[model samples]
Target: MAQAVELPDIQFAAEEAAEIQQNIISVYEGLTGRTLQPADPVRLFLSSLAAIIVQQRVLINQTAKSNLLRYASGIQLDHMGLFQGAERLSASAAITTMQFTLSIPLSFPIAVPQGTRIGVQGGDGSIFFVTEEYLEIPAGGTAGAVSAVCSSPGTTGNGFLPGQLNVLMDQLPFIQSVANLTATTGGAEKESDEAFRERIRTAPDSYSTAGPQGAYEYWAKSTSAAILDVHAFSPGNGKVTIVPLLAGGQIPGQNVLDAVAETLEDRGIRPLTDQVTVTAPTSVPYNTNITYYISRSRVSEVPAIQAAVTSAVAAYQLWQKSKLGRDINPSELIARVMTAGALRVVNAAPVYTALTATQVAQEGMTTINYGGLADD
Candidate 1:
């Protein structure tokens, strides 16, 4: 195999070039017995000319090197999606389950139309929208549950508590109000440039053929950028199980699952004998009870410290969700909590009775209680 040649760094500073020019002039004057003062027109012109030429040369070299690095297989890899042979996935809103209630029982079932805009006041005061329609409110019942997806994608949609979503759309007069029953999960930002690049680089080795497991995994992920990870399993003859995970190892909604199935079906990439099933991963919720002591100096900042710790746990949960089928390391999580400005973590009681190798953390929620000072 031929070794790839590395590009040489050719960047140079304008000031350095100017100093060299000055040194050359000084040598010339000393040898010729002619003094070249700073105020001299010739000296000023020569210095300014040298600076401009040197700066332009440096910029040209930098641009040339950058352009060379952009090419992959002789074609310039511009625009992330184009390089991957797929368009960049747009941002997707987070989806969760929400419950709506009426003040009075109804004799007949009322249909909450689909695309009915229900609003929820987020922790940051932003209003999140729930667009899914609640189709059935049982007769004589005051409440019904419906799936709610965030208006936008990202981590901002994940941490909303049950009562936090309490707004109703204007048209639904029969319904009193609505709130989320579970924290909205599976929200994520658009795929980053580097991530897209890494995926595309593997295209030749993975997605080039259709019958292999890698081909199935590649096509499944290519369906949506929101897809964080994919696991493909062939358990038996003609049975292909495809499990798609969201940003935080949470199970994707029905809509995402349907899309993946539909895309794979249309592609016809799988063998005629194979039976493909697209499904969401099973969710295993992991809750934590943290008991920690705060230093006397940080006692006054207890509230802030607690909030920080909670945020850290949430972040760790999201990270854990990205890798499906990975073990939930309680000790690692405890270490993260210790960094939240707390003096020490006396004990971290993860609700799980025993650690199982097969059980991965799907949804992680933490409840922290301060033990106050060590003496207390």
Candidate 2:
């Protein structure tokens, strides 16, 4: 009998993937002062990537590829070229044109999600959700493509340069995480009520408040140190007051309330209602302090969270060093590095040629159709 050809152990499975993802998210959520939703893996990854860039002071043009990699190591960019063209302005003069291009490759962290066969609507008047099909990736494949264009009037005797238009494309890592989560059929992350409370207690910061009136803003602004503010009143208490601080956008307030309500309800909090009331025009004062006590609960988890982040980086580094890793292409590597997110590949090519001398003059006011030149 022939010996069985054994495949190497894929040590990381769905459970491990989720834990790793959550761990990464914990770092992001802590830094951003934002609550993580069950389906927030992609958003968190993108936000965190942006945060990392911000931290490194990598603003446009001011920074380079190597600098960006300090924050996100999975992808790298190389400037391809800056092409310049010229057109004749006079018998002896020519106009000049310029174009620039860039190429970037993203590597996937794991097996890419094959698109599923999703269902639209049913024949009957009913709703339905169906998987289309699983997405697949070519073995050791690279996804490469470029898109960009620049055009301007030919250069005149007075050198005038148009502003550089930046067209950038970035991958959405959060969507990838969601796809992975969806693929994960049924396996809950393990944590008891006490454990959960402990996690919160050790978090960099935490605070509670009653109602959307203002608790959400307060809690998000406050650091990781748990600060529990138990509100004694509910909506329509006349004591309800929610002033708009960073209004117009939804943050942690509503989500926090939902999380708390779920947890409290689980613990048998009777008919506890959490609601927000937007007062009618000229109804009342529209602003009430609604006194609620905020208490700093704890701050024990910061160290552990930091430690986990370090460990994850090390693990990824080791994996990259392995022989098997060498087989992965840049795109695949980018995909893997930005786990729980979708990869957006960007390619840049010179579309418009630079303006020439004659082209430049033609584009200028040579005819000068003004009153001063109107056969005066």
Candidate 3:
């Protein structure tokens, strides 16, 4: 009888995480041909990235459509109507009209209005939008030249009132923090754990993590943390894996290595060889750089997915012009989809076998939606 066995814990090294993150970011930037905002780029990048994945399938669908068209030939109804009562001397004609719809993302860039005191409203359900008080528009100037003046009510829950103050005093990117000053001014790590914990308890999380007092103390103490990945399995039974920690940004090699180590440490394991390895970095080489990937098993499904996404986006593009649909650009949509797919493939490899349910999900699955009628 087989004994009740325990599944091995999969360790994600800091380095691996960082490496994956960098690759994903590279793909995203390549697709968009623009660097993301420094704050948080992953969510923005992935939200649109899914569209490209579907485009590959769209392409395949289109190819099939073209082939089908060859077999279909008939005089159109409109032309037949005009020729209905005409004599044999009056030649008959036909005109055919096709009906379909496409969907595409409307990418609109929003800039902060002038003198705009910007922040979300309400609580968790709040969304981002601009109001009258937030902006200071100049008379007879382009709408783009407005200045943002972030503000909020003095109530405790007034979302960004205190945040605006913090930004003014410390968080603003334009200003230098204590760490910058320390590195530049030459200061050592200061204070003790007791002091740090006391601050943590009394302070808001952000204030404790990023405020002047926290920054000065943090730098004063020259401490370091290392990440490790431990592999423990029977000989020839081991597996390797890489993960992305922050999935849409420029992550450095050292950061990747550190993140791997962090994961290993969490599992009480250390790297097998006590070192991290990574492939070469990728970047946005041009304006048309799109990246994508899929499981090997799903490769056959790419064409359909591409065609469907493309057709959908194209249909939408046509709708945008007017009730009378305009022609869609199939080629451009296909390119973006293919590029994104290629990128995903470039950075993919199995992490390990005998993994947990969540681990399997993280690696992701390849799904193909092939339910649509082809235009004939």
Candidate 4:
């Protein structure tokens, strides 16, 4: 995986009080032809003036950094993206398929009113879904499924597993049960400054129409802010396959894949000769079985060492699966645990396993066993 964009600390104007005071004293001496020593009254007065100058320079530095992609944020970042016709994405509502079942098959189509509210089991069927077009179960059919959007936008309505939402807020005659068939997904918060800045930096890749690799990457990511990594490659002629990985190593479900596909399949955006396909990456499972010991000299700090080791292991798990095609390297885990003040560390599972560009190494089970205190 490539490193994130990093810009060195930029000083548009010096904000240090000591430096400003020295420069001011030098100018005062040049103008008045006087030696300003530590006991000089004018030098003491210039100290306060230098403090005021420092505040002005702080504002100047902030204004300067706001123009660069690596440092801009909020409205400043938005303005930079406008040069390339890119805009920050707003929060969006999650979506799911609501299945409404009737007690028995009806000779005529049973109406499932548009915007019928189906709440989770505990919410008293608080009508969550926004309005949808009219849908009805076909004649002689006992059930039908229609797409539903969350009334509340953003991730507030996301992550509802199948069947978790089974209560029908609105009572309709002959409706036996109501539940969500698919997991609620696609809800996302507004794009963050870091995510939007990267887009603005890569926005130039979209200028060409020849189906460049960067263009495919930009288009795939533009579909959703949930996407963190995109790998676009061509296995053969005129065929392009793109694999997108979400944040925190969550694999893209069918709904997410469909959304990416739709975004890349636009006729105006896609070339006539190119055939694009969107797919999820394969997941390779790995287990974390670690046993670590603490040094006897650090007995008094045993609690702190154990806490640090736990945090280290958790960080390693996230780093391992954060990117697509990351290898399963137990050595990385050992290094992290050792750095966290462990005297000795042993990992039983997950030897180094190589992965293809389209496969992700996911953790299955984690067992962190402490081996008690030992000699240095």
Candidate 5:
């Protein structure tokens, strides 16, 4: 996965208060051809004026920085995003399909009314799903499926995999069972400034009819903030496929896939000639088994060094899985652990594994053992 653009620290207003006051005094002297003493009344007035001018310069610096993408934040960033036609996405409700089945094989048609509720069995009713539309089972069929949305928006309702929501909240005469057929997904909080900024930077790609790879990537990633990375490619003629990796190597569930697909299918965004498909990235699993030693010279700090090494390894695991197609490299793990004060690191698992664009490396088991103190 590509990294975000690195920005350098910059100072828009480099002039200091003293510099402004000195410049004012120099100009005044040049215009009047007279040098005023330190106690002169006119010089005092010029100093005060320079102080105000210094404040104005600070405001000017803020105004200039607000116009830039790198330093802008809050409402300033929102305005920048608006210029690219990218509005920050508000929180959204999770969606799933609830299946209603008859108690027995019914001989007559059964109607599942809209607004029916499905609850998580044996749990509080704080979060639930409501059927978006009515469903009618055929005369002899025992089951019907209807799409549903969460009662509340945001990420709280997400991650409820299929078969988790199995209770019918509302009573239906012949419906014996109700369960979610798809994972609940697409739930997210209001877009963060960083996520919105990334979208704004790439918003130019959306100007076209979604034929370019970057255009497809933009739309797919914009579907949800959980999508940390997107890989768009065309394997054959007229076919474009997108593989998205979620935060922390969490695979995109069926509901997420469907959401992304629908987002890219907008007629105005996707060209008529292009065929778009959204899929989850393949997961390449690996285990973390390692041992590290500490030098005897630093044995007095064993406790602190051990804690740092453990934290370093844990962070390495997250970094390894956070992006799509990130290879499993033992050297990286070793480097991090060593930098954390480990005298030597002996990695036993995950020697090295390369991943394709459509695959992500996942961490399975982790064991960071500390060997006894060794020679310095």
Candidate 6:
């Protein structure tokens, strides 16, 4: 069987003006029984004039074709407000929990006002604002946990550590210091043109009155680009369960879960009878132990090789997590390790118990132990 050739939506290729003028000259010469050379003054003038006229027509045609393609495919659409009539979902900011510790116990509760700025150095230097008006630090308690969100929408808000959030605003001195207990997650960059194009391309076939499985999955992902993976399941009639994982493969926090649920509910796309429950997947941590054989001549490159292998393993883990319920294949991971410019993979043993039905891979949880190279 022959494969079908996929053609571009719009035809933009055009013959050059000079080429068109040459063809016209060839026909004219044949009719007049005269040879027209570039050096001939009359022929040169006519050819130049014809080429310019042809060039203007070509530019007009190309411009019209480009506009038609953009309008038809909707590739040039910008901002979420322009998407999916009446069901627009805006970009979301990353949110995380921050811990505040007081140097000494106060006689009364201390209030950390809402919109208090807490930040880390470098990167986007994004500041996280307290979600509520007043997060109280109880008397005699040295520590308190409060929710905070990024000032703007993007992935730069994620990954702050405990000591990194040292900056605090004036008036919060009673709060002593602030730090993030958990990795700041759920931050995602704005959607790209290609990603939105794919969604629009598939939109027609995915429409359903009762909210088909594909529709649910699509809408769930549309909630946020940071939502790396979404799994929708219906065990029985009128029951829908959604599991969303973050970009780094860990389950999303409560804020993300709530946002997804609210979007689904507000969209009214799901059938009224269906009971939708949005939740995070259980985390399954995996580690690796590998022993590689290195050539005696390149013993000094051990550190570089080890770093490459570790990076490879980390990438593999992310790929595995992107697809929910996929088994962790040891052989595939070993292939990744061997491809890191190593002399030979003498032996590789990945220590991981396969995930259960409701589990997803966790990021920064995998540990790769590189057993010293066995000189060959």
Q: What is the C-alpha lDDT of each candidate?
A: 0.67, 0.26, 0.28, 0.86, 0.86, 0.68
User: Per-residue lDDT for 39-113 in model 5, tens only?
Assistant: 999999999999999889888888898788887888999888989998887777888888888878777888888
Q: Deviation in angstroms for 304 in model 5?
A: 4.4
| TM-score of candidate 1 against the unseen true structure | 0.57
Candidate 1 residue spans exceeding 4 A from truth: 1-84, 92-189, 294-306, 351-360, 373-376
Candidate 6: worst-modelled 10 consecutive residues by lDDT: 79-88
Better of 2 and 4 by TM-score: 4
Question: Best candidate per TM-score, number?
Answer: 4
What is the C-alpha lDDT profile of model 2 across 293-334, one tens digit per residue?
111231243344334433433343333222110221233323
After the best TM-score superposition of candidate 4, give how far the Cα of residue 158 lies from its true spot, in angstroms.
Answer: 2.9
Task: Look at candidate 3 and tell me the lDDT of residue 12.
Answer: 26
Q: Report each candidate's C-alpha RMSD, comma-separated, in the order given.
A: 8.1, 34.2, 33.0, 2.8, 4.4, 7.1
In model 1, the worst 10-residue window by lDDT is 68-77
lDDT of 1 by residue, 80-111 (tens): 34644655566666666777788899898877
Better of 4 and 6 by lDDT: 4
Sort by TM-score, top down from the best = 4, 5, 6, 1, 3, 2
TM-score of model 3 (CA atoms): 0.18
Residue 118 of candidate 5: its Cα lDDT? 91
- After superposition, the stretches of candidate 4 with alpha carbons farther than 4 Å from their true spots are 1-9, 124-127, 130-133, 295-300, 338-344, 374-376
lDDT over C-alpha atoms for residue 165 of model 6: 63
* Model 5: worst 10 consecutive residues (lDDT sum): 1-10
lDDT ranking from best candidate downward: 5, 4, 6, 1, 3, 2
Please give, for residues 265-342, the per-residue lDDT of candidate 3 as tens digits: 322233243332321122211111122444455566667656654454334333222211112233433444444342
